[model samples]
Structures are given as C-alpha cells and as structure tokens.
Target: MKLLKVSGILLLSSSLLFGCATMDKSTSTDKVKETKNTASEALKGVTDEYRKYAIGEIEDFVKATEAFTTAVKNGELVKAKELYGPARMYYERAEPIAEVFGDLDPKIDAREGDVPEAEWTGYHRIEKGLWMENTTKGYEQFAEQLMKDVNLLRAKVETVEVTPDILITGAVDLLNEVSTSKVTGEEDRYSHTDLYDFAANVQGAEKIYHLLNPALKKKDKELSNEIQTRFDEVYRLLNQQKNGNGYKLYTELTEAQVKELSQAVDALAEPLSQIGIVTEAS
Candidate 1:
C-alpha cells in the first residue's frame, strides 16, 4: 500500500511539471509570433518610403541623362565633359534599384571590355570617346542607345517590389561598390570621376539606413547608434575632398587621401553589415 501511495504522488508531480512545461512553450511561441509581426509591420512602412525615394532618384536620373546624351549627340565635347560626372551621379545614387533589372544595368552602365567589343555601349563607351579620344564624334549612336536604356530602366523600376531584404542587401552592395571599384579608381577608369560615384553610392546606402533606423533601434539600439556614428565618420572624410559642384577628380587625389577615405569606408561597412541580422530577425 505504501509503495502504491508513493507511486501515485510521483505521477501527480510528473503531470504537474509537464503541464507547466506545455504552458511555458505556448507562451514562448506567442512571443516569437509577436516579434515577427512587429518586424513585418516595421518593414512595410520603410519599404514603401524607400520605393518612393528610388523612383524619384530614377526620374531625376532620366532627366540628367537626357541632358548629357544630347551634348554627346551634338558633338559638344566641352559641354559633355562638364555634364558627365553630374549626370552619372543620379544613377549611382539609386544604382541598387537599377541593378535589379540585370539586362538594363549592363547595357546602360557597362565599362569598356565588360561586354563583347560589338556589344559594348552606354555611358563608359561615351566616356572613353570624350576623355580618351578627346571628342564626342562617332558616339552619337551610342548616346542614343544610352538614352533608350535609361528610359527603359526608369519604366521598369516602377514595377519593382521593395522588400526588407532588398533594402538590407542594397545597402551592403553599395558599400561593396565603393570598397572594390570606387576606392580603387577602377569604376570611372577613363573619366576619373570615381569621387562622384563613390559619394553617390554612400548617399544611397545612407538613405536605406535612415529608412530602417527606427526599426533597427527597436531591435538593437546600440548597434543602430554605432552604424550612425560610422556613417558620420565616412561623410566627414569625404567632405574634406569636396571641390566646387562636384569633387576633386580621382586622378588628383594623393595616395594618403585615398588611404584615409578607404579606411573610413571600411569602418562604416563593418557595422553596417551587422544591421541585416537585427532587422531580419524572426
């Protein structure tokens, strides 16, 4: 009888523990669901805002490209040179959205040798004509093609679905563009307009960061603050190289200036990379 009584008490304790465990699990699941809902809600607002900003930039880019290509078509060498860097800036600022349409991106911006010789066209082709060849003659057809490609890009961007993952990846890719090509003076190889592209890419990434900042703060306040600080540091370094309307041409930059700017970009990129984890958490 004693053994039976002990067994009964042990079974009752076991059942109570199991009941408590089940309740705990249900509460945990509810918390997980709640977090996911909050993240989704936050992303919806930011994504819409980012989409609007991208569309506006593309519209501005189309206008700038029109002015630029017209100068090339008319064989206005000086006018085209003056307009080149500024014209490309708009496209650089919203490049991630442009890159979404893989076909259009290459056709619009591909450097010489990036595509087959006959296939190569767009901005860089015109760039070499103006800077290396020292005239816009023979580029009128290329100019016309560039205008067509950009118009197509503007049209296609309207249909793009802006999502949180896109915002995250776009921000990272912009920085990567700077670190890899812009900093090395490889992107604008012929024109030496690397500064224009570098600044524009940073601005694009910064816009994405600002849009997601409020949500990021909710997830990880410390990290959000650190990223903001890094951005400020980068901008401070870049501002030192500023010239008139544009920047000091990349060819004019001293080796030390390049190293300083590269270091600042590296610092900013490291923390910026961590942002996706906070914003994308389930």
Candidate 2:
C-alpha cells in the first residue's frame, strides 16, 4: 500500500511540472504576438498621419502658389515680393513629397544653374525678376508655368503614399537642406528669403520627429529626450532672430549667430539619425 501511494504522488508531481511548462510556453507565444500586433498598429498610425499631413500641406501649397502667381501676373511686384516667402513656406513644408515627382519639382522650385538656363523657370526665376530686375515684366510665362506645376503637385500628392522609411529620410533631408543651402544663405539668394526656407525646413523635420517620438521613446528614452532638447534649443536660437511672425533676413544674421545656429542643427541631427534604427528595432 505504501509503495502504491508513493507512485501516485510521483505521477501527480510530474503532471504538474508538465502543465506549468505548457502554460509558460503559451504565455510567451501570446506575448510575442501581442507585441507584433502593437507594432503593426503603431506603424499604420504613423503612415496614415503623415499621408494626411502631406495632402493638406500640398493643397495649401497649391492655394498659396496660386495667389503668388496671380500677384506676379497682375504686375503687382511689391505684393508678389511679400507673398513670395510665405508662398514658398507651404512648398518647403511638403517638399519631400513634391520631390518624389522628379519632373514637376524642378519646374516649380529648381534654383538657377540647377539645370540649363532655359529649364530654370520656377520660383527662383521669378525671385530674380522681383528682387534683382526690380520688375515683374517678362515673368508672366514663368508664373503661369509655376502655377501649373503646383497644381500637378497637389494632384500627385493625393495619390502618393507615405512610408516610415520616407518619413525618416525626409526628416534627415530637411536638415541637410538647411545645412547645405539655407544656412549658407544660398537657397533664396536673390530675394534674401533664406530664413523662411530655413524655418520651414526645420518645421518640416520637427513634424516627423514629433510623430515618431512615442515609438522612439519606447526604444531609447535617453536618446529621445536628447533629441527633443536639441530641437528646443535650435528653435530658441531661431526665435531670437524672429521679426514678429517671420524671421529676419538671412543676411541679417551675424557670423556668431550663424555659427550658433549651425552648431544647434548639427547637435540635433546627431540624435535624429538614431530614430530610424530605434524604430526598426521596435
């Protein structure tokens, strides 16, 4: 009887151990599936949000550029000058999407010397007419072409898809754009509206950073916080050069001020680069 009782106890112990192992395996599998589902949903949300933003910004660009072209065609040079910076702001914000359409981007925003002189019919061409030539004469054709290109951009944006990789690359491109052109006062050289482009580019990049912050924070809170802090510092530096609602002319910045801004941008870019890696890991 004692031997039989011992045998029953051992059998019961073995069953409990096997049941516990099975439960653990099931729980781990469920956790992994749950994690994957959560990441998928988050990625979808990011993509959807960026697509909506791109569409709205492109529409706004169309409207603003239309107004700009109208001012130029009407021979209202002063009004066109005022509208120029603001008009380009919308384009700069949605530039990444516009760039996907190669043929249209050059027609709308290409700088002088970027292509053949004959092919340089865009905002910069009009910019030269307004600021350098001091007249809107002979620019009506360019203005008309610009309007058509902007409309095309709006139409194309409606169909374009925004992916996570694009968002990441766009954000980096924005900073590089500022560093290469806007910071050097080369982007809006004729009109001296580089500040407008610089600020707009920063805003564009910041939007991407803001959208990805939640996902980034989960992967590396320290790096995420550093990026946010650096962004704030850059903005603060920019705000010091603000003239009411807009920034001061790019030419107005002192060498010291320019150097400080450049450093801030570099600092931000360093941490910003990590976002793609963190996001992929998550």
For model 2, how does the per-residue alpha-carbon lDDT over 7-54 read when each residue is reduced to its tens digit? 122223322333455456567566555655565567679878988887
- 10 residues in a row with least lDDT, candidate 1: 1-10
Error of 1 at 268 (Å): 0.4
Could you tell me the lDDT of residue 103 within candidate 2?
Answer: 90
How does model 1 score by TM-score?
Answer: 0.89
Clash pairs, candidate 2, are: none
Tens digits of per-residue lDDT for model 1, 1-282: 001221122223322333455456567566556655655777778889989999999999999999999999898999999899988888998887888898988898898778998999889989999999999889999999999999999989989998676777788789888988899998889989899999999999999989878767987999889999988988998888889777888989999999988888888888887776656632
Best by lDDT: 1
Q: For candidate 1, give the lDDT.
A: 0.83
Best by TM-score: 1
Which pairs, if any, clash in model 1?
none
